[model samples]
Target: MRKAIVRVADLRQQVYDNLKERITRGEFPMDHKFQEISLAEELGVSRTPVREALALLVRDRILVQAVRGFRFPEFGPEEIVEITEIRLRLEPYAVRLAVEVLSAEKRTALAGLIRGEIARHGEADTWVAAHRRVRAALFAPVRNKRLIEAIAHYEDTIHFMRVNTLQDARWRGLSVGGSAKLADAIEAGDAGAAEAAQATLLGLARDSFLAWSAENA
Candidate 1:
């Protein structure tokens, strides 16, 4: 079946989404230079909406404004490590809560995501996809909009670090054991164990990011 063509408004949203994804994924790289007119031209859009999108990104702390133009923000090792620490504290609670409220189907899906992680070990794209899947599972039960927004904000920061650190071989294997451990805990229906496993997983991820931060520093 052929896919429907995207409308102009949808295309604008897509452009903004693509730009955000690239920036967060490090496709644009830290401190990569970009301009309103040029980026709009490249994305086949008007400068007005591109400017609007960029303005929102700057508000989101995903981009920084320079004297010349806009660039991806450069974070220090300390900043990234602290963000990981936040994830360590909050994300486990999210998963534990999810296990209580998640449907049988979602539980199955979460387990499947863990299996995917095991299967995709060492593949570059697998790392990101696996992380995303786990996060969706964790938050699937959450209904609080404000809390969700806050977590999403934190995730943006985390995604930035993940993308930045992906080039390191050490970071590649950091979550391998942790993923399986958390999945086991969740499958066993042990909330405390799930939280503990999630914490351990978060610590492993934190340590990896710290190592990357040190190297980059």
Candidate 2:
């Protein structure tokens, strides 16, 4: 906790990467507040780098400034719908591209990941991790960096909701089925089927998330 990061050149980026990992891993509770001073102390770095990292996270919409510090941003209904619309448009096409170009060996690998997703339904964490791996594998054949980056940006922006959405047992089951469909479509080299499966996958995810948001609201 007290050791400084050895990489001086990318100090700011290191800080950003570390904080982002913690956020994505659900380490910080909602009640926990982040300040430059405490973050620098925790990371054994100067306040300047910590400040810059926090600024970047805010700019990326990963966090929002609070009265005294930064906290995870809470998306409202409108923002959630907008994000869903964008993802629905982008991901299906990406999956189609991936299916069209996916190698047979990589298709086999993707099928393995999806099988794990179907089998690891015991705990939410394990299931979520498996699902994430399959999602990444689904994009392995995508050669377009910009398209992949765009998909990642929206996914990152709603990362918290995506994680929580899988906690619903029914949705998790649906997700596994959808992932299986994606694998089948990819294995068959049916770009059209892959695209349709991807749309269904994203739609189910969005609906579950919207349900959770509505209930929580």
- Largest TM-score belongs to which candidate? 2
Taking every candidate in turn, the Cα RMSD to the unseen true structure, in Å, is: 5.3, 4.8
Clashing pairs in 1: none
Model 2: CA > 4 A from native: 1-7, 121-123
**Tens-digit per-residue lDDT, 57-107, candidate 1:** 888887778887797677666776688777777777877787777766777
TM-score of 2: 0.89
Tens-place lDDT per residue, model 2, 1-217, is 6998675478989999999877765667655789999888889999999999999999888899999989889888788888989998999999888877867887776767677667765246567667767778788679999999999888778878757777678777788788888778887778899899999988887788888888877
Candidate 1 Cα outliers beyond 4 Å, as residue runs? 1-14, 103-105, 121-125
TM-score of each: 0.83, 0.89
Tell how far residue 18 is off in model 1, in angstroms: 2.5
